[model samples]
Target: MLDEAEDDRDAAAPIDMLERYFAAHGWSHQRDEDEIVAKVKGSWTEFELRAIWRADDGVLQFLAFPDVRVADDRRGAIYEAIGLINEQLWIGHFELWSSSGILLFRHAAMIDVEEAALSLEQAEVLVDTAIDECERFYPVFQFVLWGGKSPREAIAASMIETRGEA
Candidate 1:
């Protein structure tokens, strides 16, 4: 009975649920303490997703880092692009790590400690949303970084919606 209680407690941990979700999807991941790092491949690029569960605070902070870097010359434009991009997102936001010029999408969800567990569907949606946002905005960053386009131009170019195949 004691062991069963312990099992239930372990199952309720957010990090453990996230780990199981990653494994079920066959994504490469490693868990250390209260964090799980996984590599997810998106249409535009691959991303490194790091989810940290703070049980004390009952917050799950998830960050998805795309395999793109901002150049010193393009930092200003990139920052502007991020601002515009973030405005369109209903959930999560883009961040540029100034020190490293690394770009990432970050979101945090508050979980009720009493409940303690997130449904597998919730976990999937959390991860999918991050990846979807990254893929959606990747080309905007690329246009600014490599194409030397202005922030407005980059946003416009990336926002074009095509209905069917050419």
Candidate 2:
């Protein structure tokens, strides 16, 4: 539900399911903190991060945190093309965690794509794909997922973060 350029130190003011899920488990060590801009209030163990990169070679990288996956805009134009294409779809913010409530992945997904479980490994691929996708559209797009095993613990942490959000 959060864009690739948005960052929240606290949990987003939405998604009751996420809040309830977290309370049910009880894993609130870090309130969604990462290396980025803007932190919201009442964050659990996960935070949403988003950023856009423009390279001198006419390349654009749209990256989102906590997953920190990079999407290569290798289609037409990274910003102009991907931004235009993304405008057509309805996006929503989604967070996923492990069974123990560790942050795994957080990003904007198409209305249809965000409603599912994604493992850490799969999330890694997603990051790779995002980077490659960005490269495809533009010329470059790379991302880094700060903090611990966010990529590996994404699915497990998401399960917990979702509960925390509840």
Candidate 3:
């Protein structure tokens, strides 16, 4: 959701900031140049090792990811991404019930998530985070009620019966 005008014109990429941040504390973010990959519940996530030689100063860190779509049945993917954000933020974990699509995430840790060409880890975490937060804030469950009828016909009948000649 971030734009070119944002980011204060003087901030490192969210990921790079994490590295520089740790470095100031004498912590080292060491990782193989190659990518670290993993899959959770059939959703693929990739990461690389970035270590801290010293404890972080609790400075605000940003993380971003571009657009990604998740299906309804794969709600667990949302929780998995939440765990990753918790790890990065050093915060309590969260639970989610992802329910929407086409999330436009802005003001995410001061990072423009949608604008970021995020890595797999970033993509997974962000896609899930946005979905989870939206669902938590606006919980809506919609389904068709059937009475031995096709869903389409059931919907029509229900609407007609409830309208009461309107």
lDDT of 3 by residue, 1-166 (tens): 2223434224544444434333433433453222211111212222222211111332222222223344564444444444443444332233342455422222223234444322334433443454343333211111111133333343344334244564
Please give me the total number of clashing residue pairs in predicted model 3. Answer: 4
* Best prediction by TM-score: 1
Off by over 4 Å in 1: 1-11
RMSD of each: 5.0, 17.7, 16.3
TM-score of each: 0.90, 0.22, 0.22
What TM-score does model 1 achieve against the real structure?
0.90
Global lDDT for candidate 2?
0.28
Candidate 3, poorest ten consecutive residues by summed lDDT: 137-146
What are the per-residue Cα lDDT tens digits for candidate 2 across 1-166?
A: 3223323223232222233223333423222322122222222212332322222222222233332233342212223323433443333222222233222222332212233232333333434443333323221111112222222242234323233543
Ten-residue region with minimum lDDT total, candidate 2: 137-146
Please give the clash total of every predicted structure, in order. Answer: 0, 57, 4
Off by over 4 Å in 3: 1-9, 32-91, 94-110, 114-166
lDDT of each: 0.86, 0.28, 0.32
